[model samples]
Target: METQLGNGPAGIRGDLSATDLAKALRQGWRDFAARPQYGLFFASFYVAVGIGLYYLFMVRGETRWLIAAVAGFPLFAPFAAVGLYEVSRRLEQGLPMGWTHVLGALRGRGDEQLLLMGGIIFVGFSFWVIIAHMIFAIFASAAGLGEGMAFLTSQMGLTMLAVGGAIGAIIAFIFYAMTVMSLPMLVDRDVDFITAIITSFKALSANFAVLLLWAVMIAVALFAAILPYFLGLLVVLPVLGHATWHLYRRTVG
Candidate 1:
């Protein structure tokens, strides 16, 4: 069993050796694969969501409706939190990582995790909305109030789009860092939400470069996996999600 200590608000501070981290990550994948059902469940959920969205975009082709559908992405975070918690629980409890464990986590903390996930989704999505509004206001001001952004074009237009993407990326990074370890930590410890968030940030700050590498790897893998029939996500999503559980364990404690 993994050792649990009495480290309060103070979290794991020192850096982990790259070799050790790598080993943990590899082991995580092994354990994850050993329990294929967990991966399948995650993958199936992701594929269903992706297929639904693609159907909306490709078949329906309604931009407004698509945008509305996009709004639901935030809602997924709550349900995902349960999976994240389950992965951690299995790891900490020395239980066989399987479908039973995943379902058990959902059954046990379904309500609480959903509530926490809902809170996280609201705050994160609200931040996105605010930032988007700011971008809109800035664009509107430059193009003259009440007038559309017809003037934004060519190099300048692309630049604005790039800037917007950068802003979104930054938001993503912040949220990823904030929640990466926090969710699993919450499952493993009797800690409050605020502390979990704070500790997550600290872990991210401590391991920014490596975490960034992990994020890039995940993004690239996911992008490639989804390229051929979004159904591919059925395999990719679970691997990455389970891999993430391992990454957090290795990188943090």
Candidate 2:
């Protein structure tokens, strides 16, 4: 029988290797295939959210909204995977799938752990959005607040991209460390958000190199999948969501 991860300071196996990533990917694909309907249903939320944000950004023509739209989906992805985690968990337990059961799992054992974790995600994203606007403001002032392709191609504009991208990457990685296992652990166990966060940090710190590679894989795949207006999420989101649940299983005990 699989060991249940403890509520406090959950033990991390800490020996995850490259092979485990591959195996998890395979299992994730199998899970998606076994229940494509659920995958599609869950992934559709991401697609719709992505498109709506993009539309609002394009329509309003504001730097902050544009930054939010571009960065929101990628950074907020872990939270969106809750349902997929539920799906993968059910498949693992050979339990029947249903919309209500999976959706209720987002409430997370009725202890509000999921809600806390979600707040962290939202605050982190909001901070990034603010920082992103500040970065743009500096560059925009340099360009005399001119609005055109000219500034975008200028050296100052390029520097803004580099700086903003670097800071955003750091913030994203921090959230990744926080949520990579916490979300699945929350869905699978009845722990508080603090324990889940610390356990997640322990798991990442213990296997830094391998897990960093896993983060890179997620970033690259998500970038590619999101490029085509999030259509690829219908496949990529579920696969990664399940793959993450599998990874969580191996890391946290």
Candidate 3:
């Protein structure tokens, strides 16, 4: 027999079964609205820490922006896991969320999963950085040549600009395909890392348009969140985070 929705291994088993996209979307919002305080608490913590770091960096000028970006990963690592744990706790217990419950979920497998996910994140990030630098180097070298095909192309830099954009788009798609469902799948199941990644890629490929929509939405949310030193994330983060869980449910559960 097919498993009952929430009782299944990994909080999901088969393909997307729900047909009401609008209803599913509404449910995601409603689930988050039902407990706004918990959402605010989780997001506030992120904002506070993020702001504190930003202030320190601005005032001290001790680290360049690039160095700050690299150095800050470990500090924000716990919040990343906290976000996942919040989703898992709600999935497993159906309990009304609280800050304490969020923290509790972060214990045990929470940390392990975070570490594993972090490793995956680091590898992907490094790959993107390398590719980006290579792109920059190629364009910079071309621009340095004084007069010739190099100068002609450099004068109408649109070609290089188009190439850069194409490269970025391809990389973004790959990144999304690899990670779209992997974390939730990991939280919901005992699947090995390789399987989770493969499944995530499959989900991304299968639902390319919808996943791209989701990806764009996330980017917008993040931009708004950080625009005001993360205060906006107090609303955007939980809504998007919870909705993401629901999206995973629809696509893979």
Candidate 4:
């Protein structure tokens, strides 16, 4: 089945389906494979962050904080892909993919739209962290636990997971709906962040099922990639990042 072709608020978007997703994945792989260096360059940043998190978890012993921080990666990951988006965009448009051009993804067309979108994501993520900490405090105090994650396997831990995860997922999904299209759109076009966000919402509304599937795929892949000390992100993040750009191109223009 397909989302019926129609006019979107942004005058982009069309029929979206499983086939479109597969094609976008293929395109994403193609883009990354063709220019693995750029993908590697951008993904390295995540690898570094992940390594830093691992250090904090093992050395600094910030287990609870690490848990919350790890959960917040998805919120931050999309913006990191802006550079990947630039790479994918350049490849799609047949433009020169040089360091100066690709590295300047933040400056995107001399407009601040990308940065504005980033600010929205940052603020949302910060609030999410605060809520996560509060939830942790409540759960930890009631359970009488310390910084260690020993309670994670207990009944109270399970309950806290359920409550915190549900709340975290809702907040994450709201931001996902906002950024899924807008970030790429901001990179490809010079539109304001608000317009891009509205268009992103409309795109998600029109292709709810397919987009949801993609989101699940990304989340699963990211979590899996984290298992190997974040080294796996070198491959997963770039491939997924490029795939996201192609997905945006197909569904959101």
Please list the residue runs of candidate 4 whose C-alpha ends up more than 4 Å from where it truly belongs after superposition.
Answer: 1-4, 7-10
Q: What is each predicted model's overall lDDT from 0 to 1?
A: 0.58, 0.85, 0.58, 0.84
Against the hidden reference, what TM-scores do the models get? 0.71, 0.93, 0.64, 0.93
Q: Count the backbone clashes (under 3 Å) in each candidate.
A: 0, 0, 1, 0
Report the lDDT tens digits of candidate 2 across residue range 210-240.
8999999999998898889888989998899
**lDDT by residue for model 1 over 131-164, one digit each (tens)?**
6556644664565532223434534444555676
Model 1, poorest ten-residue lDDT window? 2-11
Question: Which stretches of candidate 1 lie above 4 Å from their native place?
Answer: 1-9, 17-21, 63-81, 84-88, 96-100, 107-114, 126-161
Sort order, TM-score high to low: 4, 2, 1, 3
Q: Please report how far candidate 1 places residue 162 from its true position, in Å.
A: 2.0
Q: Which regions of candidate 3 deviate over 4 angstroms?
A: 1-25, 60-101, 107-111, 126-172
RMSD (Å) per prediction: 5.2, 3.0, 6.8, 2.9
State the displacement of the C-alpha of residue 164, model 4, in Å, after optimal TM-score superposition.
1.4
The prediction achieving the highest TM-score against the true structure is: 4
Count of backbone collisions within predicted model 3: 1
Report the lDDT tens digits of candidate 4 across residue range 190-233.
Answer: 78889889888989988888899888888888899998888889
Q: Is candidate 1 or candidate 3 better by lDDT?
A: 1
Candidate with more favorable, higher lDDT: 1 or 4: 4
How well does candidate 2 score on lDDT at residue 205?
Answer: 81
